[model samples]
Structures are given as C-alpha cells and as structure tokens.
Target: MNFEEIKSDENNYLMHTYGRFNAALVSGKGAKAVDVNGKEYIDFTSGIGVNSLGYCDDGWVKAVTEQAGKIQHMSNLYYSPVQIETAKKLCELSGADKVLFCNSGAEANECAIKIARKYSFDKYGDGRNKILTLVNSFHGRTVTTLAATGQEVFHNFFFPFTEGFVYAQANDTDDFKAHIDESVCAVLIELIQGEGGVVPLEPEFVKTVADVCAEKDILLMVDEVQTGVSRTGQFLCCQNYGIKPNVITLAKGLAGGLPIGACLCSKELANVFTPGTHGTTFGGNPIACAAALEVLNRVSTDEFLNEVRQKGKYIIEKLSTFPNVKKTRSAGMLIGILTEKDNAKEVAAKCVERGLLVLTAKNLIRLLPPLTITYEEIDKGLEILKSVMEE
Candidate 1:
C-alpha cells in the first residue's frame, strides 16, 4: 500500500539487473507521477523512452482496453484485422513494403539480421554473412545482439558469441569502407546513437555512406529503436538524412506503453522470410497493434511533430541557465545533458530525490520526456533538474 512495503516486495521478487533510484513510483498521468507516499514527480525518463504518450494516456488506454475486451492475443496462425491495419499504416509512413512484428527492440533487430544474411545468401549463394556496425553502438542485451554490439565491454562472459559482426568508427567513411568486404552483407546504423550519449552523425558522412551502400549493394539497415515513432520530430530519423534504407527496426515508443516492435524492409527483402522462416506467437497481437495504431495516429502528424521540436527546444533553452550544465545535445525530445563536474548517475539520483525522473547514457544525463508532455510538466521537471545542478 505504501512505498516501503512495495519496495520490499519488489526487491524480493525482481531481478537485480538495474541500479534503481530511491524513489518508487505508483501512479501517473501525462508527465507527472506520484509515489505510494503521495509524492508527485515529473517524468522525463518515460520508462527509457517506452512511454511515448506518457502514463496511461486516455486515447491509448481506450484503444488497449477495448482491444483487450475483444481479444488479448491471437497466434500468427490466425488473421488479425488490427495487425493488418497497423502494418498498413507503418508501410505508408515509412515507405517500407512489409513489416514483421515482434515483442521488443532486440527481436526486431534479430529479424533484420536474419533478413540481411538470408537475402545475401539467397542472392549471392553464401559466405557473405558479416554485418558491420558503427563503434560505440548499443544494439541489445540478447546474446546475438550483444555480439553485434560494438562496445567491447559487453563482449565479456559470453563465450563463443555469434560470429560475423564487425565494428567500424562512426562517421568515418574510410573506416567503414576498409571494413566492408565481399563477406559483409549489411551495415546497421543508428542515426543518433542514443545510448552512446546522443551523438548525431555528420550529414556529409551519412550522404557518403548512402552512396557507398548504393554502389556496393549492401543493405543499409537503420536502427530506429529509440529515435522512431516521432521521438525525433520526424516519423523516422532517416527522413532528416533524406536517405532510403533497405530495412528499419522500430520499438520503444511505437505502442505507447505496450510491448511491440516492427522490422520493416523493402519489397526486395520482404520475401526473405517465407512461412516458418521466422516468427513469434505473440508477434502482431491485436491488442498491442491497436494500442500502436493510436500512438501512430497521434505521433505521425505534421502539427504534432512540429510541437515536439518546439517543446524539445523549450526544454533545452530552460536547461541552458543551469551553471553546471556544460551542454545539451538533442535532436527532438531525446536529450543528453552534459554536466561540468557532477556524475550523471549521481545527478540523476538527486533528480529523483527532488521529485523528478531522469535517465543516464554513459556519463551524460539523458532525458526522454513524454512526447505528449505538457509545458507545465516540462517546467516542473526542468526546475528540479536545475536545482540539482545548483546544489
């Protein structure tokens, strides 16, 4: 019933995978959350970017609840109307031909890897299975994605990880070119390196990479797990670069608060997975798809996207007044606050104590406020962050 009692049960039942803040949240609406002790806090972490529409959005709740009453889940063996409509909307929005639904970012990326390797094999007849990813990239926590990840720190304790993944320097055309060979089937990239400190790639480098992929016929797979679903002020961050990728992986914000991921590819690679080639039982469940449809409807509008950009600018502008803030880097709502002296982890803990929810990416304090966050909530959260910096 209270904070202390809930945390006691949580510690006993939950795995110790995360270094949690002291605060325990209970209820929330929009960008505001209250703990069991009735303490309110501004939510800027957005459940690590999963809560795009914020906590229990009315439209999202209605969609999900209605779908739940009708059908919670159906196997892929059965046809689902909501799934079909959501897939159609995704194709229209991204210009991708088809979609394969999964449960999380890692599963979507795993599907992409399968498509790339199998496409190469089907076309060139085998041995071209390597995937090249940029350095400092974070793919996922799965065994295969962990191997595909470029950070060496993640490579340990997992003996005999998946083979055929190579790392290249980010934004370095020469380094990527040197690593690309006849065996390399695809080059997976993140437009804004979210987990690696919100680093955006150079425009010229992106253009050159696009050109190289076009010439070499290597599939350019863009990982939009954290930046997609209008989190970057665009339906897809690749739109900003004006480049068409062969495949795109999406998750995090797609289904508002529900678990859903989509791996969409061009028509050329759409047929790579025939029946029984790859699938999930819970993939494309009607309830999750219905929830995603609402999220997509709200986020995929020009006016709403513009508001995201404006609010992002507003948050950054307010943060500029903090003396300890060295710099703020962001594309839209996803932000990284570089501080002068404080450790991001410590500052984030203090933020929770001051009644705010924040996140950390490497040494930078990351902020992924709800895309539908009100200006009043933004001010509240930023004020808490400012006071933490001042202290």
Candidate 2:
C-alpha cells in the first residue's frame, strides 16, 4: 500500500496516540531505511534507540530467526537454555546477581518497583514504601510507572495515580535529601535523563545520592532503559558514575530491535520475589532471549564500545558547528541538539521531510543513531540536518 493508504488506515483504525511522521518505512539495513516509494533515509533515531545494531543486523536476525524456527515462546514454568544464557550474560556484564525478564521498559521498571517495595517490606514491615524520583524524568507509560514518572504533565489524565511516589528535583542534592525519610524505600534515577532531555545528572550529585542511599539502606535503582546496552558507551550508564545500583532496569536496545526488558538486582535483593510473588507469561521467551544473547555478544566488547564513544564525540563536534545548534547534551550515541531558536520540534519535522529521521525530547532535537552506523551514514544524516537547520 501507498503511504497515504497506510496513513488513512492508521488514522481510521488505530488510536491517535502518536503524532507520527509522514513516512512509511518498508525495509532497512545499517543506518538506512527505504520507504514504500523507495526514498531512502539515514536513520538517526534507530527506532528510538531500539535498533542498536542498525536495521536488519545480520547476526541479530539470524539468532532471532533460528530461535523462532525452533521455539518462539514457552511458558515461564518451563526452563529454556536460551533464557538462562541471556540472564547469565546480563548478570555477568552488569554485575547484578539475578535478572527478571519482561516485555517492555515499563514492565522492567514495574518489576524494580515491586522488588524495592518487597525488599523494604520484608525487612522494615510496612509504611516504608515511598519511592523518590527526579522531576522531569520519564520512567514509563503504565499506571504505576506513570505515577513514578516525575513529570506533572503525565500525572494528569490518569486519575489518582498509584500512590507512594514523590518527586525530587534532578541534580539537586538538597531537594533529594529533603524528600528522603523513614518512609522512603527506594530512590529511582536515570544517570542520564533520556526522554526528559539527554541531560546527564551531575556526577557530584549522583555520588551524594549514592552515599545517602547506602547510609540509609534505601534501594538505589537506576533506570537504564534508554541508556543501557552500550548506548552510553558503557555496559550501563551507572558504570560511568562508578557506582553499582541496588536495582537496574534495562530495555530499548537490549535485544537489538526485539521486545525484551530486564530488571537486575544486587545479590542482597536477588531472592525478594519468590516464584508466586511476581511473574509474566512471556518474560523469558526463547526467541527474545536469543536475540538478546546476540546483542550482548557483539555490544559488550571493548572494541565496539570504544567506537561508540568516538562516534558520539564526532557527532557532538559536528552538531556544535551547525548554525542553529546552541549546545548539545550527549552520552555516547544518545544526543540532544538544543537549537538556538528553541525550535527543535520544527527542526525535527523539517529533517524528516528531507530524508533524515530524528526525535524530539521536550524541546530539543534528540538523536539516537544506531551504534553501528557508519561515518558515511552519519555524514549524510548530519548534512540533511545541517541544511534543515540553516533554513
């Protein structure tokens, strides 16, 4: 079908949740996508950071295809080697004790919330379940996760959001401390606020929070959903902070474009969920695990990670030279181009029209190009972006 037909069907049949761009991508490989009309685009968004290895990655496709051919899915009651291997790899790489697989970033964060509450309840009995999240931080879209999100905008529409969540200003040590008390069980944070703006939390503030959480025995949960799996030039963004969180939530590029989310907890909180306490039907499906394994095999390497850091630097340097760019906030491939005119939304739309896919966070032009995107692809995308900014 043509783009118009697809758009008509989408508008008529589907809910109008997303204000989608005017394009119908049909196929892609390595930082490039082709529309139904055969117009090619340099993919800077990478499906919002889900395509870590770029479109149709050879190894990732092979692993997922082979696993689907064998067993697409199985109940959690049954043990699968692929699932075990994926968990093991995650634990080994992130230094977490155990992992609970899920289907999306929201589910993974929900798991973390449950674990934090359970751990606190198991030890302190009750009334110590309030979680503190930074303001302007985006957790997920579910009821509980939405409640956990610190943005007041999300608090609306969802009537009476799940209780036990409090907001603290990001990078404000005093504000975070003021919110913390005997009732607080956990402090969930994103080292680099992705959806909020690609803004990195201050190193000193992070250190202070870590120290306070440790001293008070409050669980420190890092939501690496958008920054994990080498997107931030490290296995986990928390690693860059030189601190190990009590709980870590991962998704997005975990399976290199497949649906998979993982919540990893330290050894102390590993056994908080005892079988019936928590579960998901498709949590540990063999196919998703297989794809995750392939992603780990390729992304968790010094060579690949170094290249990611370099690419991020190069992108930032180029964006700095752009006429409309005022500044940039970046961690590895996750980048936000702050426009001088504060017209990121308009700039993003113009880029999409000119054959370059991009994203927007708040009012900044966000870019999460695939880690494996070539220099040539980067140049092409940036050229288009530069021209759009010039206009």
Candidate 3:
C-alpha cells in the first residue's frame, strides 16, 4: 500500500501513542531502508537500536528461520536447548551467574525489580523494597517501570503509579546518599543515559555509588537495555566503569531485531526466584533465543568490539566538525548531537525529509545506527545530516 493509505489505516484503526516519523519503511537491508513511496533512507535509528546486525543480517535470519521451522515455541514446562545455550553464552559474556528471559526491556526491568526486592526480603525481611534511580533516567513504559523512572513527566497520566521508588540526582553522590536509607533495597542506573541525551555518568560518581551500595548491601542494578551487546564497544557498559552490578537487564540489540529481554543476576541472587515465583510463557521462545545466540557469537568478539569503539570515535570526531553542531556526547554507536540552533526535533524532521532517519531525545539529535553499518553507510547518512544542518 501507499504511504498515505497505510497512514490512514493506522490513524483509523490504531491508538495514537507514538509520535511517529512521516516515513513508512517498507523494506530494508543493512543501513538502507526503502519507504512505501520507494524513497530510500540511511537508517541511523536502526529501529531504535534493535537491529544490532542491521536489517536482515544473513546469519541472524538463518538462525531464527532454522529454529522457527524446528520448534517455534514451547511452554516453560519443557526445556529448550536454544534457550539454555543462549543463556549460557550470555552468562559467559556478562559474567552473570544466571539469566531470566523475557519479551521486552520493561519485562526485563520488572524481573530485576522483583529480584532485588526478593533478595532484600529473603535476607532483611520486608519494608526494604524501595529502589533509588537517578533523575532524568528513562526505565520503561510499564506502570511499574514508569514508577522506577526518575523523570517526573512520566509520572503523570498513570494515576497512582507503583510505589516504593525514590529519585536521586544523576552524578550527585551526595543526593544519591540522601535519597537512600534503610528502606532502599536496590539502586538502578544506566551507565550511559541514552534517552537522557546520551549522558554518561561520571565514572567516579558511579564507582562511589557502587561502593556505597556494596557497603550497605543494597543491590546495584545496571540497566544495559540500550548499552549492552557491544552497542557501547563493550559487552556491558559497567565494564567500562570497572564495576560489576549485582543485577543487569539487557534487551534492544540482544536478539538482532527480534523480541528478547534478559535479566542477569549475581550468584547470590541467582536462586532468589523459585519456580512458581516468576515465569513468562513466551519469554524463552526458541526462535528469539536462536537469534540472540547468533548476535552474541558475532558481536561479542574483541575484533568486533574494537571496531565499534573506533567507529564511534570516528563518527563523533566527524560530527563535531559540523558547523551546526554545538557539541556531541556518545558511547560507541549511541550518539547525541547538540545542534547549534537547539532545534533537535526540527533538525531530525529535516533529516528524515532528506533521506536520513535519526532520533531526538529531549533536545538533542540522537543516533543509534546499526552495529554492522558500514563506513560508506555512515558517510552517506552523515552527509545527509550535514546537508540538513547547513540549511
């Protein structure tokens, strides 16, 4: 169907939750996508960083398709070899004792929350369930995860959101300590605040937080949903800070472009959830697990990770020279460009109209190009972006 027809159908049938882009992507491969009108675009957004291997990666497709043909899905009652293999590889990569599969970042975070609370309750008893998150952080859209998010804007319209969440200023060790108390069971953070304008927390502050959490026995949970699986040139962003979190939640690039979320826990919290305590019917679906395995196999290598870091430096350096850019903040492929005009939304729209797809976070132009995006693709996308900025 044409773009207009597809849009009309969507407006008529679907809920208007997302502020979607004007382009209607019909097909894509690698970093290039064609809209319904047959206009091609350089996909800098990568479906919000879910396409770690770019669109239609051959190995990912083969793994997913082969597994789908064999056994698409089985109940949690049955053991899945693919799921177990995926979990084992993930544990090896992240240094986690165990993993729990889910379907989205929100679910993974929910599982993390449960693990933290359960660990605290099992040891310290009840009333120690409060979690402290940094200000301006974005967790997820679920009622519970929304509560955990430290941004006040998300707190509205939810109506009496889940309780037991407290906010601390990002990078402010004193504020973090002030927000914590005997009731706090865990501290959740994103090493690089992607949605919060690609802001990387101060390494010293993070180290201090980790130290304090350790001293107080409060579980430290790092939300790697957007930064894990080599998106930030590391298997886990916490590795860059030289700290190991007790709980780590991963999604987005975990399964190439498929739906998958994993919550990895330290050995102490590994058995916190009993068989009946938590479960999801479709969490460890064979097809998603196969795709995740393929992603881990290719993206976890030192060669690939080094390339990601180099590409990130190159991109940041290039974008920094642009006349319209005021500054740039990034970790690997996750980039935020502060436009001189301070019109991120307008700049993003112009890029989309000119055959480049980017994202906007708060007031900055965010870029989450696929990990497999080529140098040529990067140049093409940046050329379009540069041209738009020149206007």
Best by lDDT: 2
Q: Write one digit per residue (lDDT tens) for candidate 1, span 151-230.
A: 99999998889999999999899998899889989989999999999999998888888888889889999999999999
1 or 2, greater by TM-score = 2
Give all candidates' CA lDDT scores: 0.92, 0.94, 0.93
- Winner on lDDT between 1 and 2 is 2
RMSD to truth, every model? 1.0, 0.7, 0.7
Q: Worst lDDT window (10 residues) for model 2?
A: 152-161
> What tens-digit string does per-residue lDDT give for candidate 2 at 227-246?
99999999899989999999
**All candidates: TM-score:** 0.98, 0.99, 0.99
Task: Give the C-alpha lDDT of model 3.
Answer: 0.93
Question: How many angstroms is residue 312 displaced in model 1 relative to the true structure, after the best TM-score fit?
Answer: 0.6
Model 1 lDDT at residue 190 = 93
Instruction: Return the lDDT, model 3, position 286.
Output: 94
